[model samples]
Target: MIVKCIDNNNCSTLTLDKEYPVIAEAPEYYVIFDDKNQETTCKKTRFTIIEDDYFTQKAKATITELNYQLENEFKDIKQFTIRKNSKGEIKEISVKFKYY
Candidate 1:
């Protein structure tokens, strides 16, 4: 089995061999933090990722903990907020989805 993974600092993805399934809510933009400062960016819908979080060694443990927390904290979260750029593109939006 092969698993694919991709990361963009503020966002990270993990895909298992095309068998095991994982689901998540989509966000328009993602917020990131760096030594310089915090920033936001656009994200395309094609992979599994978590905004404001990374799948890294230093963060692996934290991410795992968050996964469990989100599942329960957002049990009834049918809506969230996502920020967008002036260009009308999803950029630097919050990890939270924006519900109508």
Candidate 2:
């Protein structure tokens, strides 16, 4: 099963063999099983099942669009940097242009 972390600082998707029990829950964080089925703690607001085909489709579309933009819009970009959060979710992108 695929799950998404709802935490803003760690908004990333994870694949798991099966669902696990919540070891603990708090106002800011919680604990659950990670992809390896190991007990892992995360933000309380994090971790949700990725249900339905709509989300998957949208994710693919978004990736395609991002690739297109990188190839076209950023063709002239001299340098760029991608910033991701703790969960490996992209947080910010910075681009630099060549000056001639």
Candidate 3:
């Protein structure tokens, strides 16, 4: 899952308006990789989910983790295809982004 920081909660680990990946979430908080790529627990109120997909291919991870050099290349994504299993677990995610 991807999330954008909304409040930052006066913490240094997060920056408002920046997108971060939610490695996991609990009832009241989310586990996110901080700016240093360290796992940090943050309150749910600090961020809002941007996208959540249940596909095994890890497309969400791919897109968010792609090298910065390619970030521009994948900007302006045109479409996405997500496949889910019977239990609603993601099986695959295929994204089509515009190429400059």
Candidate 4:
């Protein structure tokens, strides 16, 4: 998710009004990549969400999610491949379930 800094809270690494990319998040804090590309945690009140990114929206991308789905939801013979580019970006996701 993208977030714009509204309050630095006296953090020297933060610049007021600067936008940052939140690489990870939970309920109360955002793990944002700072201006220097350093991973840092900031309170949720420190910024306002600008937009949700791929990670936040990719509901079934994580291994845990895939395991749950493949086990409980798709309990059939299957094959899958998650294609990625050289840059490690997901290009395609292929799943083949049992013909039954």
Can you list the residue pairs that collide in candidate 3? 54-90, 55-90, 55-91, 56-90, 56-91
lDDT of model number 1: 0.40
lDDT for each residue of candidate 2 in 1-100, tens digit (9 for 90 to 100)? 3446544344233443334456666677656666566777675445665553468789799677668767897665688899999999999977676677
Model 1 residue 94 CA deviation in Å: 3.0
Candidate 2: give the clashing pairs.
Answer: 29-44
Please report the TM-score between candidate 1 and the true structure. 0.20
In terms of TM-score, the best-performing candidate is 3
Sorted by lDDT (best first), the order is 4, 3, 2, 1
Task: Give the candidate order by descending TM-score.
Answer: 3, 4, 2, 1
Looking at model 3, residue 28 earns an lDDT score of 99
Local lDDT at 23 for model 1: 31
Runs off by more than 4 Å, candidate 4: 54-100
For residues 1-100, write the lDDT of model 3, one tens digit per residue: 8999999767987888999988998999999999889999999989887887565348656656555425666466777789999999999877676677
Backbone clashes under 3 angstroms, per model:
8, 1, 5, 0
Q: Would you give me the overall lDDT of model 3?
A: 0.82
Candidate 1: clashing pairs of residues: 40-92, 41-92, 80-97, 80-98, 81-96, 81-97, 81-98, 83-93
Return the top candidate by lDDT: 4
As a TM-score, model 3 comes out at 0.52
Which of the predicted structures, 1 or 2, would earn the higher lDDT when compared with the native? Answer: 2
- The residue ranges of model 2 lying beyond 4 angstroms of the native Cα positions read 1-13, 16-20, 48-100
